[model samples]
Target chain A: MIIGEQKPLDEIQGLLEDAEKVLVVGCGTCVTVCFAGGSREAQILSSSLRMSSKLNGHPQDVSDVTVQRQCEWEYLDEIEKEVAEADIILSLACGIGVQAMAKHFPEKWVVPGLNTTFLGIPVEQGIWEERCAACGDCVLGLTGGICPIARCSKSLLNGPCGGSEDGHCEIDPDIPCAWQLIYDRLTAMGREDNLLELQPPKNWQVSRDGGPRKIIREDLRLISDELES
Target chain B: MSGKDNGYLVGSHLEKMLRAGHFAVTGELGPPQSADPAVIHEKAALLKGYVDAVNITDNQTAIVRMSSIGAGTLVLQDGLEPVIQMTCRDRNRLAIQADLLGAYALGLRNLLCLTGDHQIFGNHPTAKNVYDMDSLQMVQMVTDMRDKAIFQCGDEFKGQTAKFLVGAAAAPFADPTPFRPLRLAKKVKAGANFIQTQLIYDIEAFAAYMEKVRELGLHEKAYILAGVGPLKSPGMAKYMKKNVPGILVPDEVIDRMLEAGKEWAGKKAADLSPEEKKARSKAWQTEGIQVCIDLIKEIQKIEGVAGIHIMAIEWEKAVKPIVEGAGLYPRPEVN
Candidate 1:
């Protein structure tokens, strides 16, 4: 799941300096689970902004709304009235959702209130670890289900470079050496020989290196003829 | 090279020594961070006759320096052989291949493949890294470019390939110690002609690693050069033993270095005058070279050991004394 953190109140207030009316939008999917862009967070953030403005002698009109999925166009369409009434639509979703609001509304100025961190799941009560780089090509099978592209500091293919110590990465002790984990798992499975084979240079074309990516599936698309039918 | 038994790959001095069954002696020469060519020339002069060939490091420790090939060309101009080090951390495959062509064109004969230190450890921590490929992939690519006359993209070179005596670094005591030897095997399988390991202070551990390397007959596949370095001071020794991962400096070695500064063992840093501090530092340095020389002699006795890669970064002056003390002076002249 995508993870994000709310922007600081000072920065958000600075972004809204010239705005008269503001709508604090919240996302219900990934950000909600991460407790960052959920409805409760948006309402709390909206109240804080109102109190901060009233305390500063410049009272502001600030309200909030939550969408089931802010990334999709239909959910954004549901907030058409609120979006049209506001001077700035502050998105509490990931970068994708913030752009979706601007693109769908066209005239509305959309600002991101949350910094999307990474594609990962909550590891514990309040901890999260990155699990995928979304590099487009996955080699987890060869690595015993561990993703080196996301976990290894250098994304080494034949790794656990000299930097690894005590089964942890050289950069941060909190991070486990992905290659060490792979080596242990593969060795336990009696598939240690799998590591002997060399993985060729990764073709990054399918990844972000090829620029903003799009997947067009003709089978899933609805053309004008199909819509008419 | 007689052109019959497949003689030297690049005919480099190091390759010739290994081919002639003489224990080769290689050393390192780190380029300065500035654009001054005199730094390269001065350091190259220190290592010219002390080592068979000197490895010009490529931004070692993620610190920016003169380009390895650029420094290597200057080393060549100084009448010394140079083994250029290339790391995957800085360049993509295209830039690496292009650099290989340029390095060869400038008369370089040896190459060392590395994964490079992380940018976070360098002066430019904010720099974006380009680990487009790892060291293994680099070794395979460089070897193919030399032997098959093809680029990493599989396109034919159409003319002369950049033939080099390819080398790679091995960390014998890195985490997951069971896999270190196997990693060396993978590098050897990828066509690395020689192997230089991370610096050693624990002979037991390194010898054990060599046992595994020998068990796989990787010693025959590629020449193995054990990495060695002077300690500089007891603080540096203790710091490495405690802080530097993958380096194993024993307590005894640390004790020896401490004993060198026995005259000021309990003296406070604030109490010592500048000259007294310098005198103590000189004593520590003298002992450090002795320790390194002792290590070289022991490492040479290991069954699979073929040479030593002395790394005296920023202390190139120590190489002469250490080499001479180890009875490796008057390096063999192989044509």
Candidate 2:
């Protein structure tokens, strides 16, 4: 799941400066699961903004609405009225959702309320750790299901560098060494032979280096008659 | 008129030293956290003739300091070679390439590429980490710029390209010790000309690593310099064993420090004066230097080992003694 954290109140307030009738939009998906931009968080943010404005002696209209998934247009269409009525729409979604709001409501001032952090899941309640780098090419099967691209400090293909000590990364002694975990998992599975083959340099063209990525679903897209003919 | 052989101060002394089949000794000088050139010059002067080359660390331990390039140039002014250490933690690809160009333009030649320590270990834990490329890739990039004069993006340089005698760090004592030598081989494949390993205290473990290194023929691919450092006290030994990653200060080394302290206190280990305790601490450091000299001698005997990198750390004054004690004085001039 995509993980993010709310921007500090000062930054959010700066984005909402000189604006009246602000709409704090939330995502019901990843950000919600991570307690970042869910409906509950939106409510908290609305109240906090109201209090901040009251203390500053300049009160403004602030309200919130959450969509099932802000990235999809169909779910976003449900909040068209609230978005149109507000002077500014503060998106609590990831970077994708913030762009989606601006694209759908072109004239409205849409700003990000959350800093989209990483593609990860809750390791424990109130704690989240990144597990994937979305590098486009996946090598988990070869590395014992450990994502060195995301977890290793150096993102080494053939690692545990000399810095791996006591199963911890040299970058931070607190973080578990990704390559160490891979070695342990591979050893336990009796797949130690898998690591003997050195992995070649990663193909960056398949990753973000190629440019902004897109996916098309030919099976699900509506076919135009002219094109079909 | 290649950048590798020309326009570089000291003319790649380390490369010359290693290629001449001489045991090369290098030292490390962490740039002071404060922007004080005097401190760097003083330390550089101390290590000027003691070691073949001195490494200027880049934000070592993740703590911000005077830039390594700035410090390296100062060392160059002191008439000693400097190894400009570059880390991927703070710079993106473009910035790293730019810095390398700048470093080379300043008449510095030797470069040590590293995947820097994470920011969490430093004073500013909240700073973002930019591991745009691993140390292996950094080594490859430096090699490319030197050999092909092309950037990682295949862009050709209009002017002189940054040619470096590239070096990388090796950890022989890291866990799953059998794979350590294989990692070194990979770095060599990536174009690392030489490797300076993490500190060595356990000679048996290091010997075992060297055995693997010889078996794989990695020593033939690149010069291998064993890292040796003076442990200041019994407390430092314990801290390294418990907290410092990739370092194994064996219990025996700690026991030796304790024994040194006991000897200093005349067997009455308790109720010593503050002055007496200070003396004992000095004794600990002196004993630690002896251990370093002994370790250097031990490592020198290992086949395929090129030389030693003495990281006196903050104790710059101690390098001369260790070098002289280890019979490495009058460092070879490989002009």
DockQ score, prediction 2 = 0.39
Which consecutive 10 residues in model 2 chain B have the weakest lDDT in total? Answer: B1-10
Compared with the true structure, all predictions reach lDDT values of 0.92, 0.88
lDDT of model 1 at residue A133?
Answer: 99
Best by lDDT: 1
**lDDT of model 2 at residue A190?**
96
Q: For each model in turn, which proportion of the native inter-chain contacts is also found?
A: 0.79, 0.48
Give the clashing pairs for model 2: none
Off-target runs (Cα >4 Å) in candidate 1 are A224-229, B1-6
The worst-scoring run of ten residues by lDDT in candidate 1 chain B lies at B1-10
- The C-alpha TM-scores of every prediction are 0.97, 0.82
